[model samples]
Target chain A: MNQEQFEIYRHLAGRLIDGQLSPGSHIESEQELARKFSTTRMNAYRAIKQLERRGIVSRSKRAGTRVSAPVNPNLLRQLKCEMTRRICVIHSRNSYEYLHWTGEFRRTLQQALAAEDFTLEDVHLDDVRDRAELKEKLLRLTETGIAAFILSVRGEEDEFLIENSDLFFQYHNKIFVYQSGAMSWMHWPFHTVTVNIFGEGSLAAKYLMEKGIRKIAYCRREISSKNYLDFNRERLLGVEFTMRRLSDGRNKPEEWVGLEQIYRNCMENGSGCGLIVSTDELAARIIDYFAERGAKRPPEMISFDNNSEYDSYRLTTIAPPHVEMAQTLGRLIFDNIDIDSECGFVSYIKIDSKLIINHQE
Target chain B: MNQEQFEIYRHLAGRLIDGQLSPGSHIESEQELARKFSTTRMNAYRAIKQLERRGIVSRSKRAGTRVSAPVNPNLLRQLKCEMTRRICVIHSRNSYEYLHWTGEFRRTLQQALAAEDFTLEDVHLDDVRDRAELKEKLLRLTETGIAAFILSVRGEEDEFLIENSDLFFQYHNKIFVYQSGAMSWMHWPFHTVTVNIFGEGSLAAKYLMEKGIRKIAYCRREISSKNYLDFNRERLLGVEFTMRRLSDGRNKPEEWVGLEQIYRNCMENGSGCGLIVSTDELAARIIDYFAERGAKRPPEMISFDNNSEYDSYRLTTIAPPHVEMAQTLGRLIFDNIDIDSECGFVSYIKIDSKLIINHQE
Candidate 1:
């Protein structure tokens, strides 16, 4: 139930899964493991006991302890087969707790993978109380064989991968990160599944432009917070690329136009401008904002991220297909799991988003 | 019934899956599509009609024809959820027929993915009767969105990947291949799931050595027939690396030694030599060969591949864990399916085999 038990248990189990701890091999005693992990002896013993419950280890009073031999290939297979493999989303405690967007993504991701019998849990493994706890969780996550992670690493953890790539690579191939629209490509070197914001952005622009809206505007989220804005700029870059291609570079949407000004200008002029907001939430907000302003109607609008909130608008949005992404993500991850060692090139698959005129997740 | 219908169907479905064919867009009429594909009109109509069956397209006398707009996201998901995802093993007809070994691997792979609801079949897409059919099947396999493949490339198909990598890359991230031990490294660039023949070879050497068999012998099948000999040399390299580490390598088994000579020397010397054969079949032949020579008993023996034939001896074998490999392959393939596009390098996971003492699968 506590972090200590979970940490110790996950790391040792990971070792077994990675073949780092061979079957029937003697392991560091519970006492030795506790000292090694700088945890209380009780935590280590509890961790091993958890492994025993999973048929990953065996213990006896007469003999000390060891990773149990695979009982029989058929039985070992059945034990593995009977269980559903878990995939967790590892995010900072703040992101999971405070951010509505992350929660939305988690819910959507779970819905996506649920069909495949994959359970996506919110894992606050990195949010331990202290350095020792964090160390234990990190070790457990990287070493324990229990589950794979969809790591949304922020701030220091990005630095952690750079500093400890080998220890990370020991279990690196097992985890996945989202492709972000961040300016810095720090996580570019690792395994990533991302929406092609650039391509989708451009494509959406072309599609919207063809609908005959003369004035086009771009909307954005407030960047006052520094937590996870990596994709913010990239999303715009995609939109601008499309604008530059279609129109004379003369009257482009100004950089970082606030929603208030955008709403005011379009309403005052009664110009049915084509608006590209950062998300479906913003799209709904603008429509509501116009209604609140006593305007009879709003401008032609489109948004990104097909969150379920936009279901009522019949709104046009440039949204990453979550279930399709999950399905593709499933296909991509499973495809490369076999070739990670031999193929050194990271494959950045471009997930194309569609311009949905109506409907939602 | 013919390759054209299959190709036309798979390719259009691929376009739908890839978003190239927008939902609710007017597609080429059956006559147009048939003309475009250089096929009979009936074939194209059948292909499009098949798409209609999948809820992808809708046809009527008044509406003409178009990609069906998903009436509801939940309903669309339900329709997709009803489908069975196919994972195929692509091979030449010659390879599938003459070599029964590939059948064993296919069975193991099926058993492994069976739990995940994936049915594995040997897809002879490459074995089409003619060159045009081969072209159609190859294009269909790579570009079609219907199924993922486990490509067992041999002779010409390896060259096929190099020649048409773009079309291959279009959907190359969707299939799987065995991690092979070929010295050329030609096949490593593609997606592969393979047994760690080298590592398993090394560990088997060490295990038999510890059990008191000093002089190690390596046995192999002939490469003249050109079947799946991916791990042929690497298996020996593993044992040799271990032998060199354990003792002087002056008397180690030479490469490609015929079974007759190896059987004669071990029987004549009575020096209790440990053996590593290519497979359980070769091991059975060796054991039976010894029996024909009037030896009192079989030498201390270990073999590769845990096919059920080795069961009676409780034969120690160096065979890659088919089910274990399957388990790992499932995890590996599923793990990387989501991340292949983000990761730059192809992941070749090193699959570890075990020293099975008293059983066989």
Candidate 2:
């Protein structure tokens, strides 16, 4: 942690990079390093662990640690520049859509960094399945020199990661790109990008209504996070707002559709109904579920994520501006890294979603 | 190149794995090994490179070379088992369907291995844009230690990977799992998991016929690889087969729609047409493109991949038996690995596609 220790590690890393230390060559012992750098053995060990994590060195119990000679220099240089500074991209495995977006985000980031003469060594950590595992992985990355991380915090996991923000920032300055928008409650020194879920919902409703669909139903997941709760509420309000202006006195604008009941009704007779789904993939399933039971097709349907794998169904839906979000985040990270600014505040960047109509209606 | 050198390398590898040579400890120099084994230095160097590629050794100009300190020990051990040997999984960018199937295959393989106290290690290679790159990456894995590789060979790039099958078999025997019914011309000694592309095409044609959609249109990328050509031919045959069957001495199936003309017609009058797409993503885009132009919605539409992403749009489709194929392949690999016999061929596995009808029709 001190400047002297940092300099010593840097010098050793430079030697390893230049092939001077040579992979398989035993690195100077902790005592030798301590004497050379005028540091404690503990500090030297810590530095060695850091190098090992970076894939710069290989350590074994019987074999003294040595620089890894086979480390791709190009990959190393890029990783050292991008990874050592600290940043993480996190997401859950539950939502294939989210997993995909995360992959794209990482790919775009990698491409962007390569363009700027940097390399990104991705550290994939599974979503916090349990509090202990979450804390351990988070701490490991932060303590080992990851400066910033992009995390898709969802449900209760949001609170746990946020509660440990101080611990994370202690190891290095952190930047969080919150995908689910729950970070609004946290006062962390990070930036966030989120889908305009409420806006998307309203757009879906409007598209359905435009096709003379009055009895519109909204289907969404149970809200576990405050942001998702707000999103659900806001979407309802948007649907209500549009319906109030366009509806006749007899019919209300929007109705809550229970997950279980929707399938029964869809199978019995889906005609004269319009549905606004939370996601394109879910909508496709609902459609399949109904068709399996020989249900009439709805006049209009709206879903989300035009680029979803199910796009073959040609669902009219709302699509997130993923490329734009990626570009924006890349710019922000580069700017922050360049300036080395101390400002720690959350800046929410909101982008618009597009409505795509398909043949299936 | 000779059997003797192969024997030597195999002996050294066994010692390395048994910890006779500690990780980060240098092995005999190339010249020394050549003299000791009465072989050329090139053979020794090749062996070293092979070891290096397997993450068993780290080699460099200065560091000399040594075994890699195992990072994922359990993973490495699982990889060493003979039963888990002849299996590989390949992936591509934006090809979520293929990637998802690959993941499923890996999981199935793992489960099968776990039942027999064995597990498999996945060799993931991505961003393979061309044949040269694909062949290079595949050969690298095979030469290192992979016994089999599963790849989605479609297009000219795939041809390159297949063309070099002799080189691949020279290093290690392999089995390639391609897209459904994608393999046609057989030049290599390999088994394939054929998808029922003809069946899917037949089903699509039948569905269109039932709907009285005489003016049917088909859209797909121009065939390049032998697999694609086969898939295209089968689909066309299915269409012709259906039309001939349905013809009651009066009406014939409509002309095969061309992409350029389809785009023009959809732009002019999007309604009153039936279309079958190769993929859900493309179908979604076509729908969106027409909607943006204020064209009327089509009467009937069918797409592929009952993937969740397309749920938003109520579209009829045929879902590939991805999970089934993965499970089958996993079982096959597990069985082969367990046998560990030099007798190297397995019967080709074929999976059927299921029709998933939604509100789209």
The TM-score leader among the candidates is 1
lDDT of 2 by residue, B1-361 (tens): 2444554566666665566777667887889888888888898887666666556778778887776765344233323422233355554333353524555655765676566444354554456666567557754664345545665553223454555443343334345555454433132334455555555666787788787777667766544656555566656555555554454323333433344555786555445667777667667766776687676456577877776777887778887776677666666554454322333232344456778988744
Candidate 1: misplaced stretches above 4 Å? A1-361, B1-87, B92-122, B125-133, B140-145, B153-173, B179-188, B222-230, B248-256, B310-314, B332-343, B359-361
TM for every model, in the order presented, reads 0.40, 0.36
Model 1, A109-162: lDDT tens per residue?
Answer: 666566545676566644466545654565554433324556554331144333
Error of 2 at B325 (Å): 59
lDDT of 2 by residue, A177-289 (tens): 54643224222334555555444655676677777777877776545666556556555655654554344223344443544577765545447777777667777777777
Whole-model lDDT values for every prediction: 0.56, 0.57
Q: How accurate is candidate 1 locally (lDDT)?
A: 0.56
User: What are the per-model DockQ values?
Assistant: 0.02, 0.01
Model 1, B239-335: lDDT tens per residue? 7756654553333445536677767767765757777777777878877777887764455767766667557756777555445545555765554
Best candidate, lDDT-wise?
2
